[model samples]
Target: MKRSVLKFGGSSVSDFSKIKDLADYLKSRINKNEQLIVVVSAMGKTTDDLLTSVSHLTANPNDKDLAMLLNTGEQQTISFLSLALNDLDVRTKPLTGYQAGIETRGHHLKSKISSIESDFLENLFESNDLLIVAGFQGFNEVGELTTLGRGGSDTTAVALAAALNCTCEIYTDVTGVFSTDPRIYSNAKRWEMISFEEMMEMSALGAGVLETRSVELANNHNIPIYLGKTLSDEKGTWIVPNDQMLERKAVTGVALDKEMAHVTITYPLDSKTFLTDLFYKLEGAEINIDMISQIQNQEGLQLSFTVKESEEKDLNYLFDVLRESYTNLYVKIETTYCKLSVIGAGMRDMTGVASKIFKTLLTSDIPFYQVTTSEISVSYVVDENYGEKAARLLCEAFDL
Candidate 1:
């Protein structure tokens, strides 16, 4: 018997018609001797609408309560999809994260999967040809309903595939991974195959197709991932190990992250503990800081970093507390900047990749505020208004 996991994103299961279409497609794929596991996200805009409703009730709803309410979105999808499949004479069983024995740990709003009880799922396959499971949520050790963060449905799908020891197929709006976001660069080219390491870097730098955590999990287990448009016959991109890649390019793709907040702080040079105290508080809050730079100038010790704009509120409160100790502290938070990055596995043995990026942007008269690099990637922070132009220029320069 053949077993595999399939995941459909929100855009793919947005309505009753799409659900019906997906059910028909799945029915055709299931063989008499095969068992399939399907994972699904909430209907289009359902999770966003739920959050908006909670905002109307209170600015700060209890974390546990919020998780409890948000989980209903995916549960709705699993049930609806199950009903559709059942109508077509398919033996389907719908299971929520908790029901499927997915245990999670950590915060209520952004929990991580600890382990999955695959034996329970295998037993269900004995009596059913398909199991529809909810994505993005699982129960914590304390037995409270918890949600994974944004793009978490991808993580759930990959994790389940890892546990089941099978390949994963992810269906979304995009046909496959591209050289860059097609919406930003109309000439972006779709990739036939990508290395797991390259995919992880692109995801973390801001490619929305797959979650970074999901790519990391798949890479760790050597699981192959397929990404393609839903209900389409087009050949999609396959993510595999570096050794499995057919060709390695110095720059495989360009990624643009617009949801960034640039923070620049100037503290008195005499305050030796300023940097230590500030970072300590940020670490405690679990706020990720990136592209950090520190300089000692006549004015003071200047520090600059980038963080997700969604954490602006928490950052405001953190700086307020720091103000008490350092009365001369000066802080500026700018949300009008974006990060553009280029990533590839072949860059490990390549040089001038960074030079090409810098020259491309400079010659185009684009202004960048900060820069950072890894062995496989180089990122730059530029004005949000010029982000698209910068990405396009770099894509052209690298023939991406």
Candidate 2:
């Protein structure tokens, strides 16, 4: 029998009532000849609450212990969901990431799935009509538990679908992907179909509906992902290959990432090792750097870049260490900035797109800093206060 993989986010299975409702929905979808695998995230706010509690014990908890603690949230979800399904007279089994054989690599709390052992999962499917697997947490090569970073559950679900050679359905609170966040702009249009390339651009640029890595994995394996609201009959969105699209818009969507900080450094040293040593330190810390600009003149070297505001503490610590060597390193961090981006596959064949963007912002007297571009996207950093207004203006200009 063929199998299908479905993933429900934290909000969909947040409580007992929701879990029961989801169980009924799953029962309705069960096919006599097909097996089902359900992957679920921790219930709403459980992971956050766990982190808050851990902070009470120690401000800086070890990554391994944090993973062990945070994983209980998903463990709670799987067991509760299994009980709910069995109570409905459905044959169900619950499994943790380790028990399900999801092997991962990388640092704890941000590990990536290296491989999945499907033999055990296939065996479990023989006597069970459904299997509930915890999402976001997996075991690494050293047999230590690790958690994937934010939106890891989405990655877990898509990875499972790829491994099993099955289609994936992701159920969340929203109906589907929108041209822009509906909360920010009321007229944001919902998309019925989006290409994997476009979706990957959107996610990486802070669309937030699906994690970037998950969409990348799905694209590599040619797995189409269905996204919709849980237990709702409303039409949803399908993420498919680019060739499946009938037409591409000049601009499809807009994304805003408010959690941004701009960092500038003026180093007085002209040593050749300055840039190399600085970047090597950042790489070892796993800090993602974006929008880098470097200039060398009579004033040693002036470097500017953007990074997530969430890494501010780490950036400060790293810079403090660097100061020990480069005593005259002048660093400035501005946290009042947000990154705004427009994405569309149609941009590849289009001209004047960037000009239009600059014109809109300039005419509105909204100042933007650090402009960057990809084949399908153009991003600008603007004051956080102007983020929503800039997004609305761009949406109207592009008719997104």
Candidate 3:
């Protein structure tokens, strides 16, 4: 029997009515005899609400307890969706990560899925049942419960798709990944197909379609990805493996991440020592760094990195730590910084693509304060003042 993994985000399964509607859609497919593995995220705002509760209730919420608390969001979702499916006369079972046989490498909040055993799932599929599993959280070999950090649902869907060797159907509020965040970029359109590498870069640069880690796992496993809207029939984009013959556009899409925050560190003493110390502090704060750069010309190691703006408080805490050891390790914070990325597979061999992108900026010419790149992505930073304008120009230039 053919099987497909469908992942619905919080917005898609936000309410009881939405769950009922999703159940109806699943019944149609379930009746068709397609073995369906439905991965569901916490209902809309549940995770956020959980966070708010933790902050107010406990000064230092234990990780074990916090995991227990945060996981309720998804628990509520999958079980309810399962019941709704059952009401439709479709056989269904709601399984938590531990119950679903997802084994992971004990990383707690950011666990890596080690493997998924299908012995338990075989009977479920044999019975023509719908397996609705909790997204994001998993259990390790020793039975330690772990969650997939931030966009856990996306990661959960991708991981299950790879393990099941099935097509991943990602159902979200948006019809698929867009050329840009439609809310921000008025001209932002959708792509019919995008490569895994390009999608990875997009996710890193704040592409909303799929998480970078999830895209990576899917790519490595040769799982085909489909993005779609939950309430509509509009076809979402397909993220294909790099091994395939990808039909590339001059530019697949342009994306901007407002969450970007910039940190500049200048060392007045030994740079290497200070560099090591600074990274230690960032690690302790659990801040993820991106687009890092270092410059040396007697300016004492000047280093800059981008992180999420939500880390503003965390970065402030980090600065306090740096202020302790290095008296002259001057730091500058820029809250109005954002990253703009142009993605494409054709860009690999295309000369002047970067220049064309930088040149098109002439009309708006948002001064390039910083730059970064990967084989599939070319990114730059701009004052938040001009961030959207830059995104729109790149979108128009790429004809997205």
- Which candidate has the highest TM-score of all? 2
Query: Per-residue alpha-carbon lDDT of model 1 for 1-400, expressed as tens digits?
Result: 7888999999999999999999999998884566789999999989999999999999879889999999999999999999999999999999999998889988788788999999999999888999999999999987889998888889999999999999999999999999999998899999999999999999989888999999999999999999999999899999998789877899999999999899999887665688889989998777889999999877779889999898898899899999998889999999999999989888888888888888888899999988898989999999999999999998899997
- What lDDT does candidate 3 reach at residue 106? 45
On residues 268-334, what C-alpha lDDT tens digit does candidate 2 reach at each position? 7784687788899898878888888888988799999999887898899899998898899899999
Model 3 CA deviation exceeding 4 Å by range? 140-142, 280-287, 311-324
What does candidate 3's lDDT look like per residue over 1-400, in tens digits? Answer: 6799999999998899999999999888877868899999999999999989888887666777777777788889988998888788888889998898888774466667788877677677767578999998887777877787888788888888877678898888888878888887766787777788888888978876678788998888888888889869788888887767546675788878888789888886677877787778777656789889988876577889899887777688778877888888788888888888888878777777898887888766578788887777888888888888888878877778
Predictions in order: lDDT: 0.91, 0.92, 0.82
Higher TM-score: candidate 1 or 3?
1
59: Cα error in model 3, Å: 5.1
For candidate 3, what is the TM-score? 0.92
User: Order of all candidates by lDDT, from best down to worst?
Assistant: 2, 1, 3
Q: Where does candidate 1 stray beyond 4 Å?
A: 269-272, 297-299, 324-326
Top model by lDDT, which number?
2
Q: What value of lDDT does candidate 2 attain over all alpha carbons?
A: 0.92
| 2 against 3, candidate with superior TM-score | 2
- In model 1, the Cα lDDT at residue 45 comes to 89
